[model samples]
Target chain A: MRPRVALNIKSVDYEFLQEQFGSKSELLLKSNPVHKKIPVLLHNGKPICESSIIVEYIDEVWSSSPSILPSDPHNRALARFWAAYLDEKVPLFWVITAASEEEKNAAVDQLKEVAVEMEGAYGETSRGGDFFGGDKIGVVDIAFGSMLGSARAIQVRVGVKLLDEEKTPGLVKWAEKFSADPAVKDVLPETEKLVEFAKLLSAKFKAAAASDPLRR
Target chain B: MRPRVALNIKSVDYEFLQEQFGSKSELLLKSNPVHKKIPVLLHNGKPICESSIIVEYIDEVWSSSPSILPSDPHNRALARFWAAYLDEKVPLFWVITAASEEEKNAAVDQLKEVAVEMEGAYGETSRGGDFFGGDKIGVVDIAFGSMLGSARAIQVRVGVKLLDEEKTPGLVKWAEKFSADPAVKDVLPETEKLVEFAKLLSAKFKAAAASDPLRR
Candidate 1:
């Protein structure tokens, strides 16, 4: 489940505002005017953009419970490396699926190459453990896990499957383990809903691409 | 001076390897085979790519004398937000300078917009503080400091200065303070050398752009 810090009495009013305003809330808009994107974590009225960075902020503020990142510097760096690697590379999956047929083909080739690199970077053989780091589900897993939720949607919409067990067995297994985690499982969107959202987004993007001469 | 970690006696030889390797170093090639970029910090044997991330890793690893980041979580998050923002956006300065006149104009406009946003994000009123976070030079300072060095080169080569005191007074002062810091001062490449490097890179990029029909 998406763990939220217990709101104090004063924050109750702000929490109510959050629920009322939803994604397009004035607070979110004010905090993240440039991107105006969701997942903007506002702390003390200042907004921190970007998902992975927000996760790190959360971990820092609430150090009482389960640590999101490892304590050791080397191990933490390794975890962060995988997190960043996933963040940098995984966006291409959506970009590829959203492109025209010719562009899609090129994206497919690029995706395959990236997948190979991912395997080498985080595969079971290389990492020698269930998770990217080892036994625990750390920052790296969280990073990859966030992306996997959307991967299937992109694959289905594009009719190009990239995350099959037969091809990326290690990655497939890791995803399964990550999704099964209590914290992760609680927070994840329903797969069916996510796939539907992707279908809508893909259609919208394709339609926009068709209508826009500049895009063409 | 750029602080150097003294590895164990046996690993001193590897220090030479680190220094010798540039963009094409084998260690860098292996670690960041995808990007094949430099500034990859290899701890033990694993590689952490991305300069900002590497700086954070360095700070976490060497938590002894001078901490590069603030100890408080809120301040730390703010520091990271600026660092990531600079990393993502500042490269446009180089891209603009490296492009053809038409593309160069577009890039310059984009860079100015980003600069405005950065200035606003930094706040118009100065904290009268030396670095990004209050007193000491921190992670955000390191990230931006490195980029500003390159930005100075791009500005000189392209004849379009973006970080002016009058336009972005707070940021200009921040840059000046950051560049003058003992640690940052020692690490920065000479401005003349960086300008020459930028010119060479621009020439190379223009040549490649001419050859690549897709870029056109």
Candidate 2:
């Protein structure tokens, strides 16, 4: 999704290849033998795996209008830092449908803690109003922007709000602008379909947790 | 360690703040509250967390000579890919001290598989005759170089060579050059001390695996 938003922002034309989890294409397997995961941007026969790396590749190749990553090295590091934090911390919110309510509540609290840290990370350094890398949608914005789409679906599915307006007003505002961005909205999956997909995923997660022998 | 090597390669003098795992300093905790891990480069009081990010920061700040990352965007992406691969795959080798011989053998096999892929990655792309990212000890070299140091110690303790010369001659050669590099050797801990450390770590791993309720 980030790669798509980046491409769209740069107005770079490319084909989108949707890959199913169980039936991944031979191209994906061949292009990304290491991970064999999706968002493998195949450009001129070369495949770039990993979402963040792919986005960087796109920004480098296009190198035209909107830059995803900042030009300054320190700012680039800080953007990478927050992007990495989002990757590590956002997944903890996936246990919203853990087998027990206590576990679910814990996941919510963890999400809240991560949100607060993200709020601090965005302090006084924002370029654009509300975006992490400031006014423009930089790498960190795309990183969290991609997650916010799914987070909205999860919110609808679980009937629990992870990004509370009162607690994380900045993130809330950023999400609104991010979702409203023409390029971002162009690639976002419909909320209703996402809710349905989330239901299926949450069921599998609950089943896995219930059957986990190590779970005490 | 990669950060240290990058700094050394660039001939940038800086202070080393050793961080204890069990009791991290408040500065570390404050500087990197997200992960609270070390190798946090605080240049001009701004914190750069994550070793890779720190290395990139060093390269950008002291962009005078011996750049760790490739200048080409595509090559840069590839270097980042291999570095990320090392981070993900090398840690699996640490599980070699599993409770059972079967599990230990499985871990060894996993390491061998990772080594073969790494061999292919370094095939004709080497610059420095025996280094990844060519002969210059780039980011990929530092990434794996840091791992190879501990791996040698583990080899001494376990008496099992994970980097079989026949299976991974490229990596074997690369490891030798990496260990011999002045920048790398300057920061590496003593092999004998690392061996003792490996022994203690293996014992703890075996004990934990033995008590693992999930293990059949």
Candidate 3:
């Protein structure tokens, strides 16, 4: 999604190929045999794996936009740090949606703790912009915004408010502004569909939890 | 260590402060409060966490020397992929080193299998430069080379060979060339010191394993 937002922002023409998980394509396997993961951008017959790396690659190959990363070295490092940090932190949100009943409370508490920490950090760095990367949507905004977008639907499905307006005002406001942006809206998955997927994941997780004797 | 290598290769002079793990400084915590981990590059007072990001930041900030990363986007992506892959796969070496005798055989076999796969990949892309990025000690070489340097010491301490010459000839040869390189050797920890560290880790792991009912 970060790559999509980046390409759209830069107005770079590209073909979007959806990967089917149940039966991943031979091409995907061949192209990114190292990880065999999706979001592999095939540019000029060369495949780039990893979403953050792909975003960087896109920024390098098509140097026309206001730059997905900032021009300054320190700011660029900050952007990359937050983006990578977001990737590490996003799994906690999923833990909330996927945890069994016994674990759900703990998971929600942990997620909220993470949210509070992020709020503190985000508040300290806020430039009064509509995005994490300032007035425009940059790499950090794209990465964190996409995860927060998914977290929104997960919050709804789990009926646990991890991103409360009071507790995480900075993140909540950023999420709202990110979701409302035209380019972001164009690439975001439908909220209803996301909720449905969350439900399916929750069911699978519960089933697995039930079958485990230690949990039982 | 990879960041250190990158900076050293470019002859960038700076201070290297060893962080005390027993009681980390408030400044270290403030510099990279998010991860609170080092190999954090403090350039002009701004902190950059994560080794690969720091390497890129260093390369971008000081553009005098030959670039650590390739200019071509595809090649750059490949470098990023392999560097990331090495990060993910390096833990397997420690697993092999620290596994209890009962698990040691399995761990060694698994590590060997990884070696075989990497050998195949390396053989296909060999450019006779004794490095992953070819001709010069590029980013991927710095990363994997650092790990291999440690692996060599681990191999000596564990009395178990994971990087056998016959099975992983390309990697073995690359490792030899990398360790001998003046820039890389200048920064690598003393082999004897690394062996002592490996002994400490192996003892800790064995102690933990012995107490675990699952392992028993």
lDDT of 1 at B87: 67
Q: Candidate 2 versus the native: TM-score?
A: 0.87
Candidate 1 Cα deviation (angstroms), residue B46: 5.3
Model 3 chain A lowest lDDT segment of ten: A207-216
Question: What global local distance difference test value does model 2 have?
Answer: 0.77
When sorted by lDDT, best at the front, the candidate numbers are 2, 3, 1
All candidates: DockQ: 0.40, 0.48, 0.46
| i-RMS for every candidate | 3.6, 4.1, 5.4
Which residue pairs show backbone clashes in model 1?
A1-A186, A1-A187
Estimate the lDDT of model 3.
0.75
Query: What's the ranking of the predictions by TM-score, best on top?
Result: 2, 3, 1
- Write down the lDDT of every candidate, Cα atoms only: 0.64, 0.77, 0.75
Query: Tens digits of per-residue lDDT for model 3 on B55-162?
Result: 989889887777898888888888888777776666566665576564555555656676787676566555766677677788888777777656667577667676
Query: What is the CA-based DockQ of model 1?
Result: 0.40
* Cα-based lDDT at residue B201, candidate 1: 76
